[model samples]
Target: MIEVVSLIDAAPPRVFDLELDMDVHAGSLPGSQETATTSTGRRQLALGDEVTFHARHLGLNWQMTSRISAYEPPYHFVDEQVRGPFRALRHEHHFEDLGDGGTRMTDRMSIHAPLGPLGAMVTRLLLAPYLSRLLRQRAIHIKRLAENVDRRR
Candidate 1:
């Protein structure tokens, strides 16, 4: 399990909308080159939508499909991996309005690796920290974009 929190200098709706933008997401990772291939391959993703992403990570090309199993605009959403490397993966996103044109974003991720004990060990000793860094990077990107947009407005 992993959790990340970010404070954005933008309204909840603005932050929420930016988070759902596929292009924004694709460009968030500097070197991963992640792209949405299929399923809701649009600017914004909605409930019940599925998206397939192809990217290079850890010197390996990987693809994963995930579905937006739950969504509540400007509030909360959840995406669950349908087909991916992990045995199970679910990510929950929450947005809270700060009542002052700001928003608090929280991300919680739960992952279950395959191959039993070996995978568990790998997840604990390696994957967890790697994912934490990745998530922090992503959140920082989002925060920059959101704040920049605010500045331009």
Candidate 2:
């Protein structure tokens, strides 16, 4: 499991709404060349929505389909992989109101690689750290956007 936490200088509703925006998600991982399309072809994801992402990662092109298994507006959501490189992957997003008009965002991912011992080794040594960094980078991107930083100069 990989966990990442970020504090954003914005209300929970704003942070949560941005997190559910597909365009923000793609923009956050510019280096990965990630693009996503939802089952409903909507820009925002809601309960039971599925999203398919195509990207280049770790020198390989990959595709993953994940469904929003659980969702509670402005508070929590879970996306579970339906098909992907991993044997299993479930990501949980949590937003907490700090009562100072700021939000605390937490991301927890449970990933299981395919195969047996070899897969376990690979996940521990490589996938875990790589994914952790990826999540952290995403958090930073979201934080900037939530704080109203206009980077398009």
> Where does candidate 1 clash, by residue pair?
none
CA lDDT, candidate 2, residue 75: 98
For candidate 2, write residues 5-66 as lDDT tens digits.
99998989889999999999999999999999999989999999999999999999999999
Model 2: lDDT of residue 62: 98
Model 1 segments more than 4 A misplaced: 150-153
TM-score of each: 0.94, 0.96
Steric collisions counted per model: 0, 0
Best by lDDT: 2
Score residue 89 of candidate 2 by CA lDDT.
95
Q: Cα lDDT for residue 28, model 1?
A: 87
Best by TM-score: 2
